[model samples]
Target: MKNHVLRPLWVAILLVIALLVARKLYVPADFGINGRNFTYGYYRKASVNDWKEFKVKYKGRQYCKECHEENFDSISKSKHRIIQCENCHGPAIDHPDNPEALEIDRSRGLCLRCHADLPYPGSHRNDLPAIDPEEHNPDKACADCHNPHKPDLEG
Candidate 1:
Protein backbone atom coordinates (compact mmCIF):
# COMPACT_ATOMS: atom_id res chain seq x y z
CA MET A 1 0.00 0.00 0.00
CA LYS A 2 2.86 2.48 0.90
CA ASN A 3 4.80 1.69 -2.28
CA HIS A 4 1.74 2.23 -4.50
CA VAL A 5 1.16 5.77 -3.05
CA LEU A 6 4.88 6.72 -3.07
CA ARG A 7 5.35 5.58 -6.70
CA PRO A 8 2.66 7.94 -8.05
CA LEU A 9 4.01 10.91 -5.98
CA TRP A 10 7.54 10.43 -7.35
CA VAL A 11 6.27 10.20 -10.92
CA ALA A 12 4.26 13.45 -10.54
CA ILE A 13 7.27 15.34 -9.10
CA LEU A 14 9.53 14.26 -11.98
CA LEU A 15 6.91 15.24 -14.56
CA VAL A 16 6.59 18.75 -13.06
CA ILE A 17 10.37 19.27 -13.07
CA ALA A 18 10.61 18.19 -16.77
CA LEU A 19 7.86 20.63 -17.81
CA LEU A 20 9.54 23.58 -16.00
CA VAL A 21 12.86 22.92 -17.79
CA ALA A 22 11.13 22.75 -21.19
CA ARG A 23 9.29 26.06 -20.56
CA LYS A 24 12.52 27.94 -19.69
CA LEU A 25 14.34 26.76 -22.86
CA TYR A 26 11.46 27.70 -25.21
CA VAL A 27 10.86 31.23 -23.70
CA PRO A 28 12.54 33.97 -25.77
CA ALA A 29 14.10 37.16 -24.35
CA ASP A 30 11.55 39.26 -26.19
CA PHE A 31 7.82 38.55 -26.23
CA GLY A 32 7.89 39.46 -29.97
CA ILE A 33 4.11 39.85 -29.80
CA ASN A 34 3.86 43.68 -29.56
CA GLY A 35 7.21 44.55 -31.19
CA ARG A 36 8.70 45.08 -27.73
CA ASN A 37 12.43 44.74 -27.19
CA PHE A 38 14.35 44.66 -23.88
CA THR A 39 17.65 46.48 -23.68
CA TYR A 40 20.21 46.96 -20.90
CA GLY A 41 22.48 50.01 -20.78
CA TYR A 42 25.97 50.18 -19.27
CA TYR A 43 27.55 53.14 -17.51
CA ARG A 44 30.08 55.25 -19.43
CA LYS A 45 33.51 56.18 -18.07
CA ALA A 46 34.17 59.84 -17.18
CA SER A 47 37.20 61.91 -16.21
CA VAL A 48 37.83 62.48 -12.47
CA ASN A 49 36.96 65.92 -11.09
CA ASP A 50 39.34 68.15 -9.15
CA TRP A 51 37.76 68.08 -5.68
CA LYS A 52 40.90 69.27 -3.82
CA GLU A 53 39.43 72.77 -3.61
CA PHE A 54 36.32 71.43 -1.77
CA LYS A 55 38.17 68.93 0.40
CA VAL A 56 38.39 69.62 4.14
CA LYS A 57 40.55 68.16 6.93
CA TYR A 58 39.32 66.51 10.14
CA LYS A 59 40.74 67.67 13.50
CA GLY A 60 39.53 64.57 15.46
CA ARG A 61 37.10 64.14 18.42
CA GLN A 62 39.31 65.51 21.19
CA TYR A 63 38.85 68.96 19.69
CA CYS A 64 35.07 68.62 20.12
CA LYS A 65 35.05 67.51 23.79
CA GLU A 66 36.79 70.72 24.79
CA CYS A 67 33.69 72.83 24.12
CA HIS A 68 30.91 70.21 24.06
CA GLU A 69 31.50 68.66 27.45
CA GLU A 70 27.86 67.56 27.84
CA ASN A 71 27.67 65.81 24.48
CA PHE A 72 31.18 64.45 24.76
CA ASP A 73 30.59 63.25 28.31
CA SER A 74 27.60 61.15 27.20
CA ILE A 75 29.37 59.86 24.11
CA SER A 76 32.45 58.83 26.05
CA LYS A 77 30.37 56.29 28.01
CA SER A 78 28.94 54.52 24.93
CA LYS A 79 30.38 51.62 22.95
CA HIS A 80 31.06 54.06 20.12
CA ARG A 81 33.47 55.85 22.44
CA ILE A 82 35.96 53.52 20.81
CA ILE A 83 34.94 55.03 17.46
CA GLN A 84 35.92 58.54 16.37
CA CYS A 85 33.10 61.09 15.90
CA GLU A 86 34.62 62.27 12.62
CA ASN A 87 34.36 58.71 11.34
CA CYS A 88 30.55 59.13 10.97
CA HIS A 89 29.93 62.89 11.15
CA GLY A 90 32.95 63.87 9.02
CA PRO A 91 35.44 66.63 9.95
CA ALA A 92 33.98 69.20 12.40
CA ILE A 93 36.80 71.76 12.34
CA ASP A 94 34.58 74.34 10.67
CA HIS A 95 31.30 73.25 12.28
CA PRO A 96 32.83 73.34 15.74
CA ASP A 97 34.26 76.79 15.21
CA ASN A 98 31.20 78.43 13.63
CA PRO A 99 28.47 75.97 14.77
CA GLU A 100 27.16 76.02 11.19
CA ALA A 101 30.23 75.71 8.97
CA LEU A 102 29.81 71.93 8.48
CA GLU A 103 26.88 69.56 8.96
CA ILE A 104 26.73 66.05 10.42
CA ASP A 105 26.40 62.95 8.23
CA ARG A 106 24.34 60.29 9.97
CA SER A 107 23.42 58.33 6.86
CA ARG A 108 22.36 54.68 7.04
CA GLY A 109 25.16 53.74 4.63
CA LEU A 110 27.71 54.52 7.33
CA CYS A 111 25.98 52.12 9.76
CA LEU A 112 25.75 49.31 7.18
CA ARG A 113 29.42 49.69 6.23
CA CYS A 114 30.20 47.82 9.44
CA HIS A 115 26.84 46.35 10.49
CA ALA A 116 26.03 44.61 7.19
CA ASP A 117 27.79 41.45 5.98
CA LEU A 118 30.67 43.80 5.11
CA PRO A 119 32.84 43.76 8.28
CA TYR A 120 31.91 44.29 11.94
CA PRO A 121 33.54 43.18 15.19
CA GLY A 122 32.28 40.07 17.01
CA SER A 123 30.31 42.46 19.21
CA HIS A 124 27.84 43.00 16.34
CA ARG A 125 27.29 39.26 15.83
CA ASN A 126 23.74 39.78 17.08
CA ASP A 127 23.18 42.69 14.75
CA LEU A 128 19.72 43.62 13.51
CA PRO A 129 18.35 43.35 9.96
CA ALA A 130 19.58 45.56 7.10
CA ILE A 131 17.29 48.55 6.47
CA ASP A 132 15.97 49.93 3.18
CA PRO A 133 16.43 53.72 3.03
CA GLU A 134 13.38 54.36 0.84
CA GLU A 135 11.03 52.26 2.94
CA HIS A 136 12.20 53.83 6.24
CA ASN A 137 13.28 57.28 7.32
CA PRO A 138 15.91 58.46 4.85
CA ASP A 139 16.88 61.41 7.06
CA LYS A 140 16.24 60.20 10.65
CA ALA A 141 19.54 58.34 10.21
CA CYS A 142 21.08 55.69 12.48
CA ALA A 143 21.08 58.10 15.40
CA ASP A 144 17.32 57.64 15.55
CA CYS A 145 17.75 54.07 16.79
CA HIS A 146 21.18 54.40 18.43
CA ASN A 147 22.91 57.08 20.47
CA PRO A 148 26.64 57.38 19.93
CA HIS A 149 27.06 58.40 23.56
CA LYS A 150 24.58 56.03 25.24
CA PRO A 151 25.21 52.95 23.07
CA ASP A 152 22.19 50.97 24.36
CA LEU A 153 20.00 53.86 25.43
CA GLU A 154 16.26 53.24 25.03
CA GLY A 155 14.62 55.62 22.59
Candidate 2:
Protein backbone atom coordinates (compact mmCIF):
# COMPACT_ATOMS: atom_id res chain seq x y z
CA MET A 1 0.00 0.00 0.00
CA LYS A 2 2.87 2.42 0.89
CA ASN A 3 4.79 1.51 -2.31
CA HIS A 4 1.67 2.08 -4.44
CA VAL A 5 1.20 5.65 -3.10
CA LEU A 6 4.93 6.46 -3.23
CA ARG A 7 5.20 5.29 -6.86
CA PRO A 8 2.61 7.81 -8.09
CA LEU A 9 4.13 10.66 -6.02
CA TRP A 10 7.58 9.90 -7.47
CA VAL A 11 6.17 9.96 -11.02
CA ALA A 12 4.45 13.29 -10.37
CA ILE A 13 7.67 14.84 -9.05
CA LEU A 14 9.63 13.57 -12.07
CA LEU A 15 7.02 14.95 -14.45
CA VAL A 16 7.25 18.39 -12.82
CA ILE A 17 11.06 18.31 -12.98
CA ALA A 18 10.93 17.31 -16.66
CA LEU A 19 8.57 20.19 -17.43
CA LEU A 20 10.87 22.72 -15.68
CA VAL A 21 13.90 21.36 -17.53
CA ALA A 22 12.08 21.59 -20.85
CA ARG A 23 11.01 25.17 -20.13
CA LYS A 24 14.56 26.20 -19.23
CA LEU A 25 15.96 24.68 -22.41
CA TYR A 26 13.20 25.83 -24.84
CA VAL A 27 12.29 29.28 -23.44
CA PRO A 28 14.11 32.45 -24.54
CA ALA A 29 17.33 33.35 -22.67
CA ASP A 30 16.08 36.94 -22.31
CA PHE A 31 12.70 35.85 -20.92
CA GLY A 32 11.53 38.24 -18.20
CA ILE A 33 14.79 40.26 -18.38
CA ASN A 34 14.77 43.90 -17.13
CA GLY A 35 11.11 43.78 -16.04
CA ARG A 36 9.96 42.65 -19.47
CA ASN A 37 7.27 39.92 -19.52
CA PHE A 38 7.78 36.41 -20.94
CA THR A 39 5.48 37.01 -23.94
CA TYR A 40 7.34 40.19 -24.93
CA GLY A 41 10.70 38.42 -24.86
CA TYR A 42 9.34 35.40 -26.70
CA TYR A 43 7.88 37.48 -29.54
CA ARG A 44 10.94 39.79 -29.60
CA LYS A 45 13.17 36.78 -30.18
CA ALA A 46 10.78 35.06 -32.60
CA SER A 47 10.34 38.10 -34.84
CA VAL A 48 13.64 39.95 -34.34
CA ASN A 49 14.26 40.14 -38.09
CA ASP A 50 10.66 41.26 -38.76
CA TRP A 51 11.01 44.06 -36.19
CA LYS A 52 14.37 45.10 -37.69
CA GLU A 53 12.96 45.21 -41.23
CA PHE A 54 9.79 47.02 -40.22
CA LYS A 55 9.39 50.38 -41.97
CA VAL A 56 7.02 53.04 -40.68
CA LYS A 57 4.33 53.53 -43.31
CA TYR A 58 2.69 56.64 -41.87
CA LYS A 59 5.31 59.40 -42.25
CA GLY A 60 3.26 62.20 -40.55
CA ARG A 61 1.90 65.49 -41.99
CA GLN A 62 5.36 67.04 -42.29
CA TYR A 63 6.42 64.33 -44.72
CA CYS A 64 3.30 64.93 -46.83
CA LYS A 65 3.98 68.71 -46.69
CA GLU A 66 7.35 68.16 -48.41
CA CYS A 67 5.62 66.92 -51.57
CA HIS A 68 2.13 68.38 -51.26
CA GLU A 69 2.83 71.90 -50.05
CA GLU A 70 -0.26 73.32 -51.80
CA ASN A 71 -2.64 70.80 -50.21
CA PHE A 72 -0.85 71.18 -46.87
CA ASP A 73 -1.29 74.96 -47.07
CA SER A 74 -4.99 74.64 -47.89
CA ILE A 75 -5.53 72.12 -45.08
CA SER A 76 -3.61 74.31 -42.63
CA LYS A 77 -6.08 77.14 -43.17
CA SER A 78 -9.21 74.97 -43.16
CA LYS A 79 -11.46 73.39 -40.50
CA HIS A 80 -9.65 70.09 -41.21
CA ARG A 81 -6.35 71.57 -40.04
CA ILE A 82 -6.14 69.17 -37.12
CA ILE A 83 -6.62 66.12 -39.35
CA GLN A 84 -3.48 64.37 -40.60
CA CYS A 85 -2.99 63.55 -44.32
CA GLU A 86 -2.58 59.85 -43.61
CA ASN A 87 -5.96 59.82 -41.90
CA CYS A 88 -7.72 60.14 -45.27
CA HIS A 89 -5.02 58.93 -47.63
CA GLY A 90 -3.29 55.71 -46.66
CA PRO A 91 0.31 55.65 -45.39
CA ALA A 92 2.90 57.21 -47.72
CA ILE A 93 5.68 54.74 -47.02
CA ASP A 94 7.34 54.33 -50.47
CA HIS A 95 5.43 57.25 -51.98
CA PRO A 96 8.51 59.47 -52.28
CA ASP A 97 10.53 56.81 -54.06
CA ASN A 98 7.73 55.07 -55.97
CA PRO A 99 5.77 58.26 -56.74
CA GLU A 100 2.28 56.82 -56.91
CA ALA A 101 -0.73 58.83 -55.81
CA LEU A 102 -2.45 57.29 -52.81
CA GLU A 103 -5.93 55.94 -53.48
CA ILE A 104 -8.07 58.29 -51.40
CA ASP A 105 -10.63 56.74 -49.04
CA ARG A 106 -13.86 58.24 -50.36
CA SER A 107 -16.16 55.95 -48.40
CA ARG A 108 -19.22 57.61 -46.85
CA GLY A 109 -18.86 55.48 -43.69
CA LEU A 110 -15.39 56.93 -43.19
CA CYS A 111 -16.79 60.45 -43.22
CA LEU A 112 -19.71 59.46 -40.97
CA ARG A 113 -17.35 58.05 -38.32
CA CYS A 114 -16.82 61.63 -37.09
CA HIS A 115 -19.73 63.50 -38.66
CA ALA A 116 -22.60 61.15 -37.82
CA ASP A 117 -25.04 62.62 -35.28
CA LEU A 118 -25.18 60.95 -31.91
CA PRO A 119 -28.00 61.48 -29.35
CA TYR A 120 -25.57 61.17 -26.42
CA PRO A 121 -25.17 64.73 -25.16
CA GLY A 122 -21.75 66.40 -25.68
CA SER A 123 -20.18 63.27 -27.24
CA HIS A 124 -18.65 65.27 -30.13
CA ARG A 125 -16.73 68.55 -30.09
CA ASN A 126 -18.89 71.69 -30.21
CA ASP A 127 -17.34 72.92 -33.45
CA LEU A 128 -17.82 69.67 -35.36
CA PRO A 129 -21.21 69.61 -37.07
CA ALA A 130 -22.99 66.25 -36.79
CA ILE A 131 -25.67 65.09 -39.19
CA ASP A 132 -27.85 62.03 -39.54
CA PRO A 133 -26.31 60.50 -42.68
CA GLU A 134 -29.56 58.92 -43.88
CA GLU A 135 -31.52 62.11 -43.31
CA HIS A 136 -28.85 64.68 -44.27
CA ASN A 137 -28.02 63.29 -47.70
CA PRO A 138 -29.36 59.79 -48.38
CA ASP A 139 -27.54 59.16 -51.66
CA LYS A 140 -24.77 61.75 -51.74
CA ALA A 141 -21.26 61.41 -50.41
CA CYS A 142 -19.86 64.15 -48.13
CA ALA A 143 -17.23 64.98 -50.77
CA ASP A 144 -20.01 65.64 -53.28
CA CYS A 145 -20.71 68.95 -51.56
CA HIS A 146 -17.74 69.40 -49.21
CA ASN A 147 -14.08 69.77 -50.14
CA PRO A 148 -12.02 67.42 -47.95
CA HIS A 149 -9.01 69.75 -47.81
CA LYS A 150 -11.24 72.67 -46.78
CA PRO A 151 -14.37 70.73 -45.59
CA ASP A 152 -16.98 73.49 -45.37
CA LEU A 153 -20.01 72.72 -47.52
CA GLU A 154 -21.16 76.34 -47.86
CA GLY A 155 -17.71 77.78 -48.43
Candidate 3:
Protein backbone atom coordinates (compact mmCIF):
# COMPACT_ATOMS: atom_id res chain seq x y z
CA MET A 1 0.00 0.00 0.00
CA LYS A 2 2.83 2.48 0.95
CA ASN A 3 4.87 1.68 -2.21
CA HIS A 4 1.84 2.22 -4.47
CA VAL A 5 1.33 5.85 -3.16
CA LEU A 6 5.11 6.68 -3.13
CA ARG A 7 5.56 5.56 -6.76
CA PRO A 8 2.94 8.03 -8.11
CA LEU A 9 4.39 10.91 -5.97
CA TRP A 10 7.92 10.28 -7.31
CA VAL A 11 6.65 10.28 -10.93
CA ALA A 12 4.80 13.57 -10.39
CA ILE A 13 7.97 15.26 -8.92
CA LEU A 14 10.08 14.09 -11.85
CA LEU A 15 7.50 15.38 -14.36
CA VAL A 16 7.55 18.89 -12.73
CA ILE A 17 11.39 18.95 -12.74
CA ALA A 18 11.46 17.99 -16.45
CA LEU A 19 8.97 20.77 -17.31
CA LEU A 20 11.11 23.37 -15.43
CA VAL A 21 14.26 22.26 -17.27
CA ALA A 22 12.49 22.42 -20.66
CA ARG A 23 11.14 25.96 -19.91
CA LYS A 24 14.59 27.23 -18.89
CA LEU A 25 16.17 25.85 -22.07
CA TYR A 26 13.43 27.17 -24.38
CA VAL A 27 13.21 30.72 -22.92
CA PRO A 28 15.58 33.41 -24.29
CA ALA A 29 18.70 34.41 -22.31
CA ASP A 30 17.79 38.16 -22.39
CA PHE A 31 14.04 37.80 -22.08
CA GLY A 32 13.66 41.15 -20.20
CA ILE A 33 15.29 44.54 -20.88
CA ASN A 34 15.03 48.28 -20.06
CA GLY A 35 12.38 47.81 -17.29
CA ARG A 36 10.02 46.00 -19.70
CA ASN A 37 8.73 42.60 -18.49
CA PHE A 38 9.34 39.18 -20.12
CA THR A 39 6.14 39.13 -22.25
CA TYR A 40 6.89 42.58 -23.78
CA GLY A 41 10.48 41.54 -24.55
CA TYR A 42 9.31 38.28 -26.14
CA TYR A 43 6.80 40.05 -28.43
CA ARG A 44 9.29 42.83 -29.26
CA LYS A 45 11.88 40.23 -30.35
CA ALA A 46 9.28 38.51 -32.53
CA SER A 47 7.93 41.75 -34.16
CA VAL A 48 10.86 44.24 -34.04
CA ASN A 49 11.57 43.84 -37.77
CA ASP A 50 7.94 44.56 -38.76
CA TRP A 51 7.91 47.80 -36.72
CA LYS A 52 11.28 48.89 -38.20
CA GLU A 53 10.03 48.30 -41.76
CA PHE A 54 6.60 49.98 -41.24
CA LYS A 55 5.78 53.19 -43.17
CA VAL A 56 3.80 56.06 -41.62
CA LYS A 57 0.29 56.59 -43.02
CA TYR A 58 -0.60 59.91 -41.37
CA LYS A 59 1.94 62.67 -42.04
CA GLY A 60 0.15 65.21 -39.82
CA ARG A 61 -1.20 68.80 -40.33
CA GLN A 62 2.26 70.26 -41.12
CA TYR A 63 2.68 67.86 -44.05
CA CYS A 64 -0.76 68.81 -45.38
CA LYS A 65 0.04 72.55 -44.95
CA GLU A 66 3.10 72.18 -47.21
CA CYS A 67 0.94 71.93 -50.38
CA HIS A 68 -2.46 73.14 -49.07
CA GLU A 69 -1.48 76.44 -47.44
CA GLU A 70 -4.70 78.28 -48.32
CA ASN A 71 -7.04 75.63 -46.90
CA PHE A 72 -4.74 75.12 -43.91
CA ASP A 73 -4.78 78.88 -43.22
CA SER A 74 -8.58 79.00 -43.47
CA ILE A 75 -8.99 76.02 -41.12
CA SER A 76 -6.49 77.50 -38.63
CA LYS A 77 -8.62 80.65 -38.25
CA SER A 78 -12.04 78.92 -38.04
CA LYS A 79 -14.03 77.17 -35.30
CA HIS A 80 -12.88 73.91 -36.88
CA ARG A 81 -9.24 74.78 -36.10
CA ILE A 82 -8.94 71.81 -33.74
CA ILE A 83 -10.16 69.37 -36.42
CA GLN A 84 -7.60 67.68 -38.69
CA CYS A 85 -7.88 67.79 -42.51
CA GLU A 86 -7.57 63.98 -42.72
CA ASN A 87 -10.53 63.64 -40.34
CA CYS A 88 -12.84 64.92 -43.13
CA HIS A 89 -10.59 63.73 -45.94
CA GLY A 90 -9.12 60.22 -45.79
CA PRO A 91 -5.43 59.42 -45.24
CA ALA A 92 -3.08 61.38 -47.56
CA ILE A 93 -0.43 58.65 -47.66
CA ASP A 94 0.25 58.69 -51.44
CA HIS A 95 -0.88 62.29 -52.07
CA PRO A 96 2.60 63.83 -51.79
CA ASP A 97 4.32 61.46 -54.28
CA ASN A 98 1.35 61.04 -56.63
CA PRO A 99 -0.89 64.07 -56.17
CA GLU A 100 -4.66 63.70 -56.57
CA ALA A 101 -7.71 65.58 -55.36
CA LEU A 102 -9.01 64.05 -52.13
CA GLU A 103 -12.73 63.19 -52.04
CA ILE A 104 -14.51 65.28 -49.37
CA ASP A 105 -17.09 63.67 -47.08
CA ARG A 106 -20.09 66.10 -47.05
CA SER A 107 -22.56 63.73 -45.44
CA ARG A 108 -24.91 65.11 -42.74
CA GLY A 109 -24.15 62.05 -40.59
CA LEU A 110 -20.48 63.01 -40.60
CA CYS A 111 -21.32 66.52 -39.40
CA LEU A 112 -23.71 65.18 -36.75
CA ARG A 113 -21.06 62.88 -35.25
CA CYS A 114 -19.74 65.79 -33.16
CA HIS A 115 -22.69 68.23 -33.51
CA ALA A 116 -25.66 65.97 -32.76
CA ASP A 117 -27.76 66.91 -29.72
CA LEU A 118 -27.52 64.37 -26.93
CA PRO A 119 -29.74 64.36 -23.83
CA TYR A 120 -26.68 63.98 -21.53
CA PRO A 121 -25.79 67.20 -19.67
CA GLY A 122 -22.30 68.71 -19.95
CA SER A 123 -20.49 72.02 -20.75
CA HIS A 124 -19.32 70.55 -24.09
CA ARG A 125 -22.92 70.56 -25.31
CA ASN A 126 -23.07 74.34 -24.72
CA ASP A 127 -19.68 74.85 -26.43
CA LEU A 128 -20.73 72.84 -29.50
CA PRO A 129 -23.94 74.01 -31.22
CA ALA A 130 -26.34 71.10 -31.67
CA ILE A 131 -29.67 70.95 -33.50
CA ASP A 132 -32.31 68.33 -34.25
CA PRO A 133 -31.45 67.37 -37.85
CA GLU A 134 -35.05 66.35 -38.60
CA GLU A 135 -36.51 69.71 -37.52
CA HIS A 136 -33.55 72.01 -38.47
CA ASN A 137 -33.85 71.30 -42.18
CA PRO A 138 -35.65 68.03 -42.90
CA ASP A 139 -34.31 67.36 -46.42
CA LYS A 140 -31.25 69.62 -46.56
CA ALA A 141 -27.66 68.52 -45.91
CA CYS A 142 -25.57 70.31 -43.24
CA ALA A 143 -23.23 71.49 -46.00
CA ASP A 144 -26.14 73.33 -47.64
CA CYS A 145 -26.09 75.93 -44.83
CA HIS A 146 -22.60 75.37 -43.38
CA ASN A 147 -19.22 75.71 -45.06
CA PRO A 148 -17.03 72.81 -43.93
CA HIS A 149 -13.80 74.83 -43.94
CA LYS A 150 -15.26 77.71 -41.89
CA PRO A 151 -18.44 76.01 -40.41
CA ASP A 152 -19.43 79.07 -38.26
CA LEU A 153 -22.48 79.79 -40.54
CA GLU A 154 -22.44 83.42 -39.31
CA GLY A 155 -21.50 85.06 -42.62
Candidate 4:
Protein backbone atom coordinates (compact mmCIF):
# COMPACT_ATOMS: atom_id res chain seq x y z
CA MET A 1 0.00 0.00 0.00
CA LYS A 2 1.10 3.67 0.51
CA ASN A 3 3.23 2.62 3.52
CA HIS A 4 5.36 0.23 1.42
CA VAL A 5 5.92 2.82 -1.33
CA LEU A 6 6.80 5.58 1.15
CA ARG A 7 9.24 3.31 3.02
CA PRO A 8 11.16 2.44 -0.19
CA LEU A 9 11.23 6.15 -1.25
CA TRP A 10 12.54 7.21 2.17
CA VAL A 11 15.31 4.58 2.01
CA ALA A 12 16.25 5.72 -1.49
CA ILE A 13 16.45 9.35 -0.37
CA LEU A 14 18.62 8.35 2.62
CA LEU A 15 20.93 6.33 0.36
CA VAL A 16 21.33 9.35 -1.96
CA ILE A 17 22.16 11.59 1.04
CA ALA A 18 24.71 9.09 2.32
CA LEU A 19 26.42 8.94 -1.11
CA LEU A 20 26.57 12.77 -1.27
CA VAL A 21 28.11 12.94 2.22
CA ALA A 22 30.71 10.27 1.36
CA ARG A 23 31.66 12.07 -1.85
CA LYS A 24 32.11 15.35 0.02
CA LEU A 25 34.34 13.73 2.65
CA TYR A 26 36.57 11.51 0.49
CA VAL A 27 36.52 13.02 -3.02
CA PRO A 28 38.29 16.36 -3.47
CA ALA A 29 36.62 18.26 -6.30
CA ASP A 30 39.37 20.86 -6.69
CA PHE A 31 42.23 18.37 -6.49
CA GLY A 32 43.08 18.82 -10.20
CA ILE A 33 44.17 21.88 -12.16
CA ASN A 34 41.43 24.37 -12.98
CA GLY A 35 41.60 24.86 -16.71
CA ARG A 36 39.83 27.38 -18.96
CA ASN A 37 36.86 25.42 -20.25
CA PHE A 38 37.14 22.38 -17.95
CA THR A 39 39.73 20.88 -15.52
CA TYR A 40 42.50 18.26 -15.35
CA GLY A 41 43.02 15.05 -13.37
CA TYR A 42 46.30 13.46 -12.25
CA TYR A 43 48.00 13.23 -15.66
CA ARG A 44 45.39 14.64 -18.02
CA LYS A 45 45.54 18.35 -18.69
CA ALA A 46 42.87 20.78 -19.80
CA SER A 47 43.28 21.69 -23.46
CA VAL A 48 42.04 25.23 -22.77
CA ASN A 49 44.15 26.58 -19.88
CA ASP A 50 47.66 25.12 -19.77
CA TRP A 51 49.39 28.18 -18.31
CA LYS A 52 50.26 28.60 -14.64
CA GLU A 53 48.19 30.86 -12.43
CA PHE A 54 51.11 32.81 -11.10
CA LYS A 55 54.85 33.29 -11.58
CA VAL A 56 57.30 31.71 -9.12
CA LYS A 57 60.72 33.07 -8.25
CA TYR A 58 63.94 31.07 -8.44
CA LYS A 59 64.43 31.12 -4.67
CA GLY A 60 66.91 28.26 -4.68
CA ARG A 61 70.74 28.10 -4.33
CA GLN A 62 71.48 30.78 -6.93
CA TYR A 63 69.34 33.26 -5.01
CA CYS A 64 71.30 32.43 -1.82
CA LYS A 65 74.64 32.72 -3.65
CA GLU A 66 73.88 36.32 -4.71
CA CYS A 67 73.71 37.48 -1.08
CA HIS A 68 76.50 35.35 0.38
CA GLU A 69 79.33 36.33 -1.97
CA GLU A 70 82.23 35.27 0.25
CA ASN A 71 80.72 31.95 1.30
CA PHE A 72 79.42 31.44 -2.22
CA ASP A 73 82.87 32.14 -3.67
CA SER A 74 84.46 29.54 -1.38
CA ILE A 75 81.77 26.88 -2.05
CA SER A 76 81.98 27.56 -5.80
CA LYS A 77 85.09 25.41 -6.01
CA SER A 78 83.57 22.38 -4.30
CA LYS A 79 82.05 19.40 -6.12
CA HIS A 80 78.85 20.29 -4.28
CA ARG A 81 78.79 23.67 -6.01
CA ILE A 82 76.99 21.95 -8.87
CA ILE A 83 74.36 20.88 -6.35
CA GLN A 84 71.80 23.26 -4.84
CA CYS A 85 72.10 24.25 -1.16
CA GLU A 86 68.59 23.02 -0.36
CA ASN A 87 69.45 19.54 -1.65
CA CYS A 88 71.38 18.42 1.45
CA HIS A 89 70.17 21.11 3.82
CA GLY A 90 66.46 21.83 3.95
CA PRO A 91 65.67 25.52 3.26
CA ALA A 92 68.18 28.39 3.69
CA ILE A 93 65.89 31.00 5.25
CA ASP A 94 67.11 30.93 8.91
CA HIS A 95 70.69 29.72 8.24
CA PRO A 96 71.57 33.23 7.04
CA ASP A 97 70.54 34.79 10.40
CA ASN A 98 73.58 33.46 12.31
CA PRO A 99 75.52 31.12 10.01
CA GLU A 100 77.54 29.77 12.93
CA ALA A 101 74.55 29.50 15.33
CA LEU A 102 72.39 27.52 12.93
CA GLU A 103 72.90 23.76 13.14
CA ILE A 104 73.43 23.14 9.41
CA ASP A 105 72.35 19.59 8.63
CA ARG A 106 75.67 17.95 7.68
CA SER A 107 74.66 14.33 7.98
CA ARG A 108 75.89 11.62 5.60
CA GLY A 109 72.36 10.26 5.87
CA LEU A 110 70.93 13.52 4.47
CA CYS A 111 73.18 13.25 1.43
CA LEU A 112 72.04 9.65 1.00
CA ARG A 113 68.44 10.83 1.22
CA CYS A 114 68.51 12.23 -2.32
CA HIS A 115 71.41 10.07 -3.59
CA ALA A 116 69.26 7.04 -2.66
CA ASP A 117 67.64 7.28 -6.16
CA LEU A 118 64.71 9.67 -5.71
CA PRO A 119 66.18 11.55 -8.71
CA TYR A 120 65.08 15.12 -8.33
CA PRO A 121 66.63 17.66 -10.73
CA GLY A 122 70.39 18.29 -10.21
CA SER A 123 70.74 15.29 -7.87
CA HIS A 124 74.27 13.85 -7.39
CA ARG A 125 75.49 10.56 -8.77
CA ASN A 126 75.23 7.44 -6.60
CA ASP A 127 78.83 6.59 -7.56
CA LEU A 128 79.96 10.00 -6.38
CA PRO A 129 82.17 8.68 -3.52
CA ALA A 130 79.77 8.76 -0.53
CA ILE A 131 80.84 6.63 2.47
CA ASP A 132 78.66 3.63 3.18
CA PRO A 133 77.54 3.55 6.86
CA GLU A 134 77.42 -0.24 6.95
CA GLU A 135 80.94 -0.46 5.49
CA HIS A 136 82.51 2.53 7.26
CA ASN A 137 82.41 4.40 10.58
CA PRO A 138 79.61 6.92 11.21
CA ASP A 139 82.02 9.59 12.50
CA LYS A 140 82.57 10.72 8.92
CA ALA A 141 80.23 13.36 7.54
CA CYS A 142 80.31 14.97 4.07
CA ALA A 143 82.32 17.82 5.61
CA ASP A 144 85.13 15.40 6.41
CA CYS A 145 86.12 15.19 2.73
CA HIS A 146 84.66 18.36 1.26
CA ASN A 147 84.59 21.63 3.20
CA PRO A 148 81.17 23.24 2.71
CA HIS A 149 81.94 26.96 2.90
CA LYS A 150 85.54 26.66 1.75
CA PRO A 151 85.83 23.51 -0.36
CA ASP A 152 88.73 24.03 -2.75
CA LEU A 153 89.76 20.88 -4.61
CA GLU A 154 93.07 22.54 -5.51
CA GLY A 155 93.86 22.98 -1.80
Highest-lDDT candidate: 2
TM-score of each: 0.46, 0.66, 0.68, 0.44
lDDT by residue for model 4 over 1-155, one digit each (tens)? 56977999999999999999998898655445444443433433442345564444335878777777777777677666777766655656556666664345877777665444443356556445544566555576766875665555357
By TM-score, is 2 or 4 better?
2
Give one digit per residue, the lDDT tens place, for model 3 in 18-133.
Answer: 99999999987645464666656334353666788899777788989988999999989888889888888867888767667565687888988888877676757656778887
Give per-residue CA lDDT, model 2, range 128-149, as digits (tens): 6889888988898778888998
Q: Which candidate is the best by TM-score?
A: 3
Please provide, for model 1 over 61-106, each residue's C-alpha lDDT reduced to its tens digit, 9 standing for 90 to 100. 8887887788877877766677787786677866845776666776
Question: Model 4 — TM-score against the truth?
Answer: 0.44
* Total residue pair clashes for candidate 1: 1
Itemize residue pairs with steric clashes in candidate 1.
Answer: 75-149
Sorted on TM-score, best first, the list reads 3, 2, 1, 4
CA lDDT scores, all candidates in order:
0.66, 0.81, 0.80, 0.62
Which run of 10 residues does model 4 get worst, by summed lDDT?
39-48
In what order do the candidates fall by lDDT, top score first?
2, 3, 1, 4
The superposed Cα distance between candidate 1 and the true structure at residue 147, in angstroms, equals 2.2
**Cα error, candidate 3, residue 23 (Å):** 12
In model 2, the runs with Cα more than 4 Å from the true position are 1-53, 125-127
